[model samples]
Target: MERERMVRKTEIVQVLRMKEGTGDTSFAKTAYMARQILLMTKSIREKVMKELYYCMEQPKILCIADLGCSSSVENNLMSVVYGLIDTIDKARRELGHGPQEYQIYLNDLPGNDFNTVFSSVTRFKDNLKEKMGDDFGDCFVNGVPGSFYGRLFPTNSLHFVHSSSSLYWLSQVPEGIEDNKRNIYMAKTSPPKVLKAYYDQFKKDIWMFLHCRSKEVVDGGKMVLTLLGRQNSDPCYSNRTGYMWELLATVLDNMVVEGYIEEEKLNTFNLPIYTSSPSELEFLVHSEGSFALDQVHASEISWDANDHKNRSSCDQYDFAICLRAVVESLIVSHFGEEIIDEIFKRYREIICASMAEEKNSVDYITISLTRKSRG
Candidate 1:
């Protein structure tokens, strides 16, 4: 018989988005950690701006894109993009260039809530006009819905590209790893083949990403990527990156034991995430040969990288809510919606139990690159 079908019938693009709305299930509420990653990479953003200053002279239109720009509760994530626009505008003006028009693209998967982002455009423009007064150049923002694994824009159309808390997501689940039953991601117990499958998928996706972006971004354009990563030189099975999934697996296993979900279904499920190390990223950049790596910075961020004192007091609940906002769509599609609340309830208990034993967090790597001039 042909190899067993491991890939599910569900489409990833339609199911991988954060919960839609401004509530706790919404990505806006749960993606505070992503915003924190953006803040942490402020220096990288500045460096890209400086590079852009030298790349162009008296340009009239600046094309910038925020890849994986999901909708937020307060539209704060776009504020990060807005900050990018402001910095680029300021840098151009400081170089004595006249006002330049801006074409901004906010990209995410088709299932994303673009309506929310579009709803804020008027307010965003109004704020820009107010902040810069007469100096503000007209800005046109549009939503581009597609996966970044392939070309999403025309060749040589973009100047600056930014993605934060994205890219760690593989294009799709790796092939052939479904045999590693009982785990939704790479874990300490994952066999060597399973780990290799995950790494190979990441390598291909990252390379394809760089290759596609190389064609889309103009020569000398800059791209900044902040990704979930591991600081350890080689952490294929490190707890820092896989512990959350391990706990999630525990919950799933228990659910299977209690007949809450089918064992085969749980065994077939696998998350499409793979945290990278600085060395791995560097090697990919070199192998791709289209962009020059400008800088790589790594830092550790707690799972609860949000304002707990202000938003909510329960750490376990906060963590569960954040994870649920992103993974619930997948879980609900694969396991059915009825089990979501109970699954996360069990998840929270596991998180609390893990915390009681020791604190947990993961490393983030910020990589800056400049597109080399086309030969």
Candidate 2:
């Protein structure tokens, strides 16, 4: 794992297939996020709705944006958006609030596949139109394809901001990391250089996100973010906390060494892996001075948990399902189709072995911040 690696994988199987966030591969996982959002803030959300009810009475129009809304409209993303949108409409209707005009900006990097997001949003808007029947009111939706690290909109212009399952990704790895070509990221033993590089990059990315949002958010604007995270830091990925992709990466690496695939094909491609807790996130955001931290909730979205327990002992069989689809897809895209089967087989064996050794837990941190009203 180079500190500063850029995506250059030429393999067809693994190219552009890595699971970056709460990916759509798992139906159960996706549903969990939708449900978790409701459960995590049932009371708080109710209060917000009440506030909005009064706010809707004002003559001022509302503007909201979902930053880093990557072009890929995964099933999970769509469900969350539609669910959120539906909830908002219900809030307005309950207050007898006729169409409080809202402008929603769906943002993502320019290189993202916007076709999928645009196509899906268009269809979703059509569905809404059919239901609303000429009473669409003032809600308008459009895609903003660009990076969020820079100012994408005017200051003091937004009323609300939402980024679900985004952030935690560094804008770039530390400089000169890839140049070393030492594979410092992957080592049997702890390497201080590699660890520092990874941590430093994470810190920088966090700052970029905070600074970027701080620049664009209006006074008193609210931002709700749901993203993947880890309970404790162990670069080893030993926690087995739904770290299927990491397992899959090991599988891919093994396949390459076994002569199942060419190693050179993978160096070109890189996947952004980020895991942090709610407090850690708050620290970074607060440090940026753009947003005032308000509420923080830890949602228990572990798929393998029993009785919906936030922490569940890892089981090899159940864990395999979560990791297989994601890892295999990523490998196929980056490493070519030749080693897909081998990679999967090896990955399965390793995951099972790890599970047999002991227990694992999966969890996510949701942080809600109120953007500081600009001076």
Candidate 3:
């Protein structure tokens, strides 16, 4: 049974990806919230760039990797990469350094829409050349398809790494949580064993991630990661992410009761994501022993991606669409495509009803780390 469960997980990983393309219902349209969060951390990224400029000898080429770089026509991976190049170029000029080439690796799982990402590169380069004129060096964009939990780059190849809204996803679902019952994530009703299992799995995955990056990132290189997190220490606390999952589970439960989905299927499924606390992240980084913690900051944003004072039904619908863009693929893979529209319909209603009573917000944790010299 355990072997069978592992195989199931392998299959899920193989198919896991965000909804593709530039349509209204696609991840590209729904990712404005993620883009905002990335923009919020722009200052920290600038600081990292400045430090990188001062710390290392001016290289002819600067190599950067954006792990889990999902595809989008606008306001997505390419936007962030372009912003980084601008930051780098500005810093070089400020420091009186010569123009340098850039090698940007846009990485995500194999299931990602690489064609869309690749198709945008020519326009991206043309825009850069137009903007920077002779100051713009040869900027190369490449797509890397693989899991970030393992090695993806050559030894000491990357000088900087950035990931946003991605690390919360585990390499696989946590094992030994079949008894989590109706919950798809750690909840107040979850057994203590379930919480431990989730945390342990995160620990294992994060440690392996750090170990792999340690081999690939140059000493003194910097990494900035941002993901959904909780300020509260208890795993079962009713944080916004947990509450959202609870609402999703509630919808699935109703579907099962109405015979729309199999009870056994709902019983065995769990999301391959975990929200970590600041302390938990700090502990893992210290234990990994490769990266020195530079800074960790936690901030909250409204779940509806609007001002709390003036949220409307339209905001609720947009929130539902955003959530669907992220998890619809997983739901379809597990239950079937027939239920996608119905599930999200009920999910949107539930969210609207719930928000009528109280506002919902999620905390985002951003951490910056510098690779320490090998002992």
Estimate, for each residue in 1-375, the C-alpha lDDT of model 3 and write its tens digit. 879867865776687888898788888777656766777788887688778867888887899898888876345544577778888888778788888899988899999888878888898888888987777677988899999988899999999999989999998888889899878889888999999999999999999999999999999999999999898898877576678889999999999999998999998879989999999999999999999999999997776666644333345567788889888888898898988999999999999888888988778899999999975
Residue pairs clashing in model 3 are: none
Query: Candidate 2 — which residues are off by over 4 angstroms?
Result: 1-60, 70-78, 90-97, 129-138, 176-188, 233-246, 261-270, 303-337, 348-361
Residue lDDT tens for model 1, 61-111: 788888988887234434566677678777867777777788888898998
Provide C-alpha RMSD values for all models, in order: 2.6, 5.8, 2.3
Listed in order, each prediction's TM-score against the native is: 0.93, 0.72, 0.95
**Location of the lowest summed lDDT over 10 successive residues in candidate 3:** 307-316
Task: Please report how far candidate 2 places residue 339 from its true position, in Å.
Answer: 2.7
- Tens digits of per-residue lDDT for model 2 on 88-117? 677767766666566778886554456666
